[model samples]
Target: HREAHAMQKDWMRQSGIEEEEKAPSIDNFEKIAAERVHLGLLVNELVLSRELKLDDEKVKTKLAEVTNAYPNGDEIRKMYEQNSELMDQLKSTVMEDQVVEWLTERSSFNEKEIEFKELINNNQ
Candidate 1:
């Protein structure tokens, strides 16, 4: 958590986003973190969009798969269709996912196996 907070603060400074007058309290950290992550995704999507064309049908299909995981999937789908804001947000998320997938496909990485305990200890 401390590492995450530090990273968030660093990102805000580098991205020219101003923090509030008060320090971010524990109660608001989750919201702040979510906003930071969302902004990062948007930026990444913008860069990826310039390099690769996105298909609207793929976005819709992914959204459908996600929405169907919920019990009220039909209603949720209707809500997105009826609300432009929600629909746009869904499209943005789907596009980001596509961008990530594309990048992953082209990237190479070395997998290092580590114990769960070691991973937790390292993070701490």
Candidate 2:
């Protein structure tokens, strides 16, 4: 579906309808991949060190949050519920969020709003 969306957008762009997208470079992709790996390691370490556990309800909640955007959301959700691989992936993602929340709760940081440009610049 993502590939299909991109193909549609590309055709629109060629037709002079859609605006050019600002996708980052492969170098940025590598950086982001590394950062994700580091985060996954940190989450795992904390999970083991703090003895944190995943809640089944969180996975269900995450699934609902994920599927609610689609047209046939309820149907997709039901299908996902019956798929072991998708359920396992969702469970892992929920655990990652739970671990991040645990870290955030114990840490101190100032909250400030920034522009979209600034956010993208910072990421780059």
Candidate 3:
């Protein structure tokens, strides 16, 4: 932050905007944080309400499938170490998908395959 401020000061001096007053504060940091927490809780509840279960065996199998993409064992281990928390998050996501799959498996949910180009065009 100190370096960023220093660089900003230099830029301001160069641009002859040093005398300009600081921008007004929105002062909604807490509100934004609360909203983010609320969104996270909402998503988690959605996953949980679906009764998603992620067993250790499933996690291992998924990991094995993922590791297949990384030919180097050390690279895979390094990636896992660097993103252990992300791994847990992915596991949770897998559990949620399992719930979705389970529901769709029991009850038929009519799904149609659209061409990739058509789907993108429609989204845009």
lDDT of 2 at 68: 97
Per TM-score, the best of the predicted structures is 2
List model 1 lDDT by residue over 32-67, tens digit each: 667767777776766666666667898789779878
**Model 2 regions more than 4 Å off:** 1-28, 110-124
lDDT of 2 by residue, 1-124 (tens): 3434545565566777644455333343455456666787888898999999999889878999989989999998988889988888798899999988998899998999999999999999
TM-score per model over all chains: 0.54, 0.60, 0.44
Off by over 4 Å in 1: 1-27, 34-42, 45-49, 70-72, 113-124
Give the number of the best model, judged by lDDT. Answer: 2
The segments of candidate 3 whose C-alpha lies over 4 angstroms from its true place after superposition are: 1-43, 81-83, 109-124
Model 3, position 112: C-alpha lDDT score: 94
Tens digits of per-residue lDDT for model 3, 1-124: 3433444565567777755355222232345556656765765785678665577777767776777777796578567658978688668766756665676788866799999999999999
Report how far residue 45 has shifted in candidate 1, in Å.
Answer: 6.5
- Model 2 Cα displacement at 36 (Å)? 1.3
The TM-score measured for candidate 1 stands at 0.54
lDDT of 3: 0.64
In model 3, where is the ten-residue run with the lowest total lDDT?
A: 20-29
The better candidate by lDDT, 1 or 3, is 1
